[model samples]
Target chain A: MIDIQLSERQEKIIDIVKANQPITSEEIAKRLSFTRATIRPDLAILTMSGILDARPKVGYFYSGREAMSFFTNQINSMKVSDIKSLPIVVDEQTTLYDAIVTLFLEDVGSIYVTSEGFLTGVVSRKDFLKNSIGGVDLNKIPVGVIMTRMPNIVTITPEDSIIDAAVKIMEHQVDSLPVIEETVINNKHGYKVIGKISKTNIVRVFVDLCKNN
Target chain B: MIDIQLSERQEKIIDIVKANQPITSEEIAKRLSFTRATIRPDLAILTMSGILDARPKVGYFYSGREAMSFFTNQINSMKVSDIKSLPIVVDEQTTLYDAIVTLFLEDVGSIYVTSEGFLTGVVSRKDFLKNSIGGVDLNKIPVGVIMTRMPNIVTITPEDSIIDAAVKIMEHQVDSLPVIEETVINNKHGYKVIGKISKTNIVRVFVDLCKNN
Candidate 1:
């Protein structure tokens, strides 16, 4: 894929096409006082880029497709699994202090809480700090006691697009999301935390996009 | 700007140009068993998109420019000031408790510290969480006692690109950066906090790019 800036004449051609739908190249050229050969390349670019649709005998029609659609397509094609990081999970019985320690040790923004190897809740540094300042005994309280519980946590599956993950993070005002897969634990349904996506991850992807470009 | 996926024949034309660079259009057409007239549109596209360069009477040469260069240019053109949020700031004498309160009240990941309207330090949720768990007297210690002080804080000017901000955030492993402008405060050279760019801002930009596209 390649991106190109439209020349002035090409822009004029689009304007002309918009003003006169199904206009033939000859008419377009005549309108601009240029011969058909002079504008053929411009027409080719506009049509090839999908800005203009050319029917066999129907001349040109505006397609209304923007150039940035390529950017959107590229982002949408990236799956969460392609960029997710390993989630830091702690058992429900683990003390808040231990969980916080794990967060520090792993340098992760949030920790996933699991009960019997299935996702139950999530705790972030904000949650930990809020509780820490509230005079709670970090060593006595279980991490699950302070977590945002299941069904309330915003999550994404590996199959979801990274754009979907980014949207959830922004809309929910959360720092990170757990990438999970639905599972059956014994007789009950649950989600197994498999990966993690955070604002940091999103930023990394953004940097990488620019870097690779 | 527009992005386009090269057609099969267009791709073949590029391959031919790469191998026989400086070859004329007529020669390229002969190799592909097509008339020059039939390949004119493809040559126009390859040359216009900068994937191939055509010199008058000298034929075409591989430009070696990738399509994503447009994406890179678009991102680099965005200035930090274009999207930086109002900085959440606190005075040096404000107690850690009050700083934490400000952090919550503003719902920002980090808070900038100022002394006489000049940036002096920065404190993040992680710092607060660490001190909160350390048995420190949050109500007694001033934020200046715990913040990552000047010269240590990674900062950006308003003129810096948002890409620069993202790179610094990722490299420093920090949640946010203070947008600062140099100033003279009581004859001491320092930076005055102007705005802030955080992981959240980066995510928002990423989302907006996809949305706009």
Candidate 2:
């Protein structure tokens, strides 16, 4: 739900903390030219909402770490499938050069490489460097050789929590996770590439959650 | 060059094509459900703006393959300074449990592990899984054993472009890049532990850019 309750003054204060956090309360009051007393309640409410972060003897600042807290607390918590990007996929036969072109063209950082409709491997930009940098003939080489083959692929289901995906990203350190429905590419629609969850998407959600919670 | 000359409808049409690109003119017509006559001028203007994309017989889409193109344009053009995140550093003596807490608290996918103020190993969730999980001792172990050690580390400079980082991510198949200001960790607050750029940050940029562009 949108926060329609915070006063304009409070909103500005929240924005200020977000813009330059890890700042002192006294410093914030001095720079904004507001009295410490006047800023207290705003800070208090914002902190309670998970927007402002306060540590004893450390003063106050905006919390970038607040997202997970809010997610664990609020959000009415929806299924990851309720809101995920449909993944973009490519075939093993796709040339390295074309895969790079496709990655940029589709505005994605990774591509799922398949063979005969089975999840064979995934070709991401991370794998492209050793293979694509020099004038290696991208047209002649198939994406198969450079992919992280399946049975070892990291994936998530639609029913999982968003934080679950976020954890996978940090743990696995991959940019995106293909939200699979049994088989990601072999789904009924050929659009089996349904729902992608990227770290940036999580961050945006983090920002929003921080502001409101 | 900014695309400011196109009319609102033309821009809208271009956005629509981009949203579900690799689509045919007929399919684009179906999604927006626009008439052939209504979409003609918009397509023409987008083509004039160098925003048009087409397959030999596959109909139309948006083009962002160049510097001004959607996916690669901004990241490709971004200087390393713009997108790097604030860094969180941990001394080599820190325990694995502490690193886990810091990792979760900071919301970053990885943590830079330094020894005597120089670039050393990097500890990520993957490392934790390999070393920490399935073990009887969870809190006592050090992260150094599981980290990607210094000389083996791949990094980018604070001066590089986001595209360069993207290429690294794709090429090296790593989750995040540490923005190095030199292997030195300075005493001055201004220079130490400068920034980090994660794959998640890139996803956020693309989502917003896709919407507005």
Candidate 3:
């Protein structure tokens, strides 16, 4: 993680930039009740950090990409609770048709396959493709028939950082993470999903934070 | 548009906030080679504009969502280039299976469809689903056969704001935007596929921009 250390003064300057970027340093000094001469040095430090862009007469602006990197560098600070939405799971007994409809309506790319109420496997859009583009029976074939089963699953706790979660997505080459309460990912046992986190959700959180940066 | 006027001091504070947030007012004073006493009031004024958030000890931060809202508030300062990226489209003659696979591999939910290299229609997973779900010939059928024909599509340009792109996604119930070079979409004459933009992309961009803060 890049420990972006900002002195109290530097921090205050960043706050000001975020508050009114694509602005001028002279104007900023007036608003913060500081003098242009005082804020100038601080602005220089920020520019050196590649955190802010300065236009002589026009003023300064924050680079959105740069600002977001500062926070994500330490995504370990994020908790599973930070991503609170739960995912709707499907039973292995569920049919292909149901899975398709569910996936579309929920706007998710995959679903956990469970038996009773525990996760047994995972089925994705790719899994559905193997059988079609043909009309087929969703009821006859169990979701477990195509799902990538336990022991091969990747799960995260509510306490995991956003960076940790992002790594899993990249490594697994999967679109989403099934947040589990308890994990014994083996065929003999089962994975119980409590919630879900997708690449989209992670991105959403960062974007929201940047907006407020 | 959110025409909140900025005092010179307020502008400086905003600049600083953008440079580095999760910062304290005391830090701002030191960096500018000034005293914290001088920066507090200015910070307070900017915060009152609803552009920055100041937590007594935590310092201040920027507000991006509010900025996005302002972009959407009117056409005055709003430009298509703001939210616009390049465009990406596929040939109508392309097979359905190939398109679906491309969408999956690219991690994108939709792709623009065209004929003779001109915009003609749009094919989304949902559009494919109603027919693709049943056992059918994704290989044999041309994507043009299933895509949403041109002139009926909703799109935006490079000058538009992020909010405009977002609103289009929500309104069309579509997940992405295929930035088109041509003002008019012709099903038979597809435009050059420059880049792709999506809600997911927006989220990712934001998360990336504010990772540090």
Per-residue lDDT for B87-153 in model 2, tens only? 7889887887787778767766689988777767788655653353234354676777678887677
Q: Score the docking of each candidate (DockQ).
A: 0.58, 0.03, 0.12
Better candidate by TM-score, 1 or 3: 1
Off by over 4 Å in 3: A1-78, A105-107, A134-139, A183-190, A210-213, B1-88, B93-98, B101-108, B135-141, B159-173, B183-192, B203-207, B210-213
What is candidate 2's TM-score for chain B alone? 0.62
Candidate 1 structure quality by residue, lDDT tens digits, B18-112: 99999999999999999988888888888887889989999999998765656677788999999999999899999999999999998888999
Give one digit per residue, the lDDT tens place, for model 3 in B148-204: 877777766665566566556655756677666653445433454555666655554
Q: lDDT per residue, candidate 2, A92-122, as tens digits?
A: 8888777877876786667887666655677
- Residue A15, candidate 3: alpha-carbon lDDT: 78
Please report, as a residue range, the 10-residue window in candidate 3 chain A with the lowest summed lDDT.
A65-74
In model 2, state the lDDT of residue A97: 70
User: How should the candidates be ordered by TM-score, best one leading?
Assistant: 1, 3, 2
The per-residue C-alpha lDDT of model 3 at residue A201 equals: 70
Output the lDDT of residue A86, model 3.
73
By lDDT rank, best first, the candidates go: 1, 3, 2
